[model samples]
Target: MRKLFFYTKQQFFNFKAMQTAAGFKLLSMSQLLSSQKVGELNKNQKYYVDLSSVMGYTKTNDSQQMLFEQLFDSFGENIDFICDKMYEEDIKYIFRYIFDDFSDVDAASEEIIAEKETIIETPSRKRRIVDLNDKELDDFFKVFDASLYGHERFKEEFKKLVTAYRVFNKIGEHKILSLFLMGDSGVGKTEVARAIHKALGSRTKLAKVNFGNYSSHDALNSLIGSPLGYIGSDGGELLKRIQESDVGLILIDEFEKADSAVFNYFLDVLENGKVVNSQADEYDVNGYIIVFTSNITKENFRSKVSPELRSRFDYKGMFNLLTDTDKKKYVHFRVNQIISKYKEFVSEDIPDGLHDRVVCEVDVSKYKNMRDLNKKIKDTFVKLIGA
Candidate 1:
């Protein structure tokens, strides 16, 4: 009797390695069992069946045993089966009864497969923002405040929003806290979302969708996916962004640029706290905080977005250019960050007071734009470090 081989779950997905070691093509056990006919096999071809998928086919032990016996009898010498480490005695008994010997692949092949265990052991993707423990929550505000400079009024309002969200989350009445920020080109409008993302300790890219690109007639189609039967109708940009993100916070930049259809779509999102794709898949955005940043003035905002939609925003505020004092604070923060990064990476140590030198050289008063100021900081660092 041919010996049956068992493979761990980690080795299943590594098709290349499995093929190389087993000299066979891999097939799912479920697919074979579900199919009405077993196709003819090539003389040299060998097939592997994953037993985990087979276990899901039936519930009872007797049924599983019967299925296993039939599968072994039908496949005969044409196939080998693989399974994750099964501890169940009944399942082991079936394997023992079917085959005379149980064997693993050669040691060299086992080593190659063992190396891939790390890939399998990796934790599943993080979907939502990890809730802060009581101690962490207490310190959250302080970190948040420090990260975002200027906008003291906006900070207080945001704190209130967060407090309300935590309280009302249980009642399920209030779903999402939506903030609409209007400001000039280079003020910290988008920074509000960034600060929150950082405070939440997100290691993933911030979920950002710039509606400026979706200003065309097909704006809604681009934001959410195209309908079925339409070309490229897989999934929408917003849904894709949300899925890729590790946190619940989403930043929609250039909100004023999108058309009416997109606006109405977001209206539903904010009210229902769910984003439904064209495919009708609903993503729960409840307890999420979405920050919408726009460059439109207050007059234009009123004229462009309807009053009904305007009223739905939890907080609407205009972000102003940072005060000189706040600008200096930003300079200090940026300088320290650059210096720390420099110290960590660069081996050459020139001056003890490089941070002070760099900060003093950057003239915050000369630039009103944060982007320009950031450029100045980079320039100053390059000049000082001679990198």
Candidate 2:
């Protein structure tokens, strides 16, 4: 009963915190809307959002959308109830409504502030991007270390990254620190990209893209939008996202499998620090750090490319191979995680020396190393349980 009450209180506190946050946001939104000049909108624009329809739903939208200017204005102070309900569609609708109202109002201070906050609150950064300064860079590295299990060499490479940043800053030029990270699969190349996204202090970033997906014209078009009269409209997914963020990271995995045409697109970005669109305009890529990963070797790549094409990348480094001790550590680490996860699912104590038996019994040679050990265990579990 005490634990239940404690949990209830914790939930209450969380709700209260969320309420306060929503209240502040609503207040800010209100202030911004009122302060901006909506120009002829107040007299001419017909509000298209349906307020009664939104309220009929049981929840408020996390998307923070509202229709009708009067609706937002009237309920500005009471928006906490709306945001607290996780009604994303409603929130997005209302948000776009508010933005539309502000944009019609001449997109003044209120509109700018509203859009800026909306961008910041988005899962990806929208625009007016900022880069990590030296002190923030240090904090970023610190968090990167804390997020992972083990990678002493990764930490060392990160220090080299700090030096790289300093070099870029001193040169008064904005160009990517291009890196080619080659290693065995699941050895943390992907994880490192995620860490950089979390650490780099940039509002705009992406960590990974598989080269195999870029086979069709639509696939390439999906990254950056297509020309007018295209079936559906997107702002060009990857390219626009990167441009809007200003400073971001792009982690391209399995580069060897990407179509040659994709490399043709990338050549300009690597050499000139710009991505040219179909419209003939250029997006500055100097603000980005592009990391490409592949299992292919230099000889194979050279065979595939001309000498001029090979010269585009700035830095290339091999991912470190795991040692025998490292492999053992990974095995034990995974075993502990599995035990902890399933301990509650089973009522009785685990079978005597079962973990040890499993670890000791598996034929390690059928797969690569520690990474395979976990896969083998998972496969074994699936076979036994029909999972």
Which candidate number has the best lDDT? 1
Q: Give the clash count for each candidate.
A: 1, 18
lDDT of each: 0.72, 0.51
Give the alpha carbon lDDT tens digit for every residue of 50-159 in model 1.
56665544445555676666666667465776655552343466566676766543212445545534343222233223345555565557557867889999899888
Candidate 2, after superposition: displacement of residue 101 in Å? 54
The TM-score between candidate 2 and the true structure equals: 0.52
TM-score of each: 0.66, 0.52
- Across 42-71, the per-residue lDDT of candidate 2 in tens digits comes to 221112222223433424443333333444
Q: Which runs in model 2 stand beyond 4 Å of their true positions? A: 1-118, 121-130, 133-135, 143-155, 183-188, 201-207, 216-235, 240-247, 279-285, 306-309, 335-366, 369-371, 377-387
Off by over 4 Å in 1: 1-130
Model 1 vs. true fold: TM: 0.66
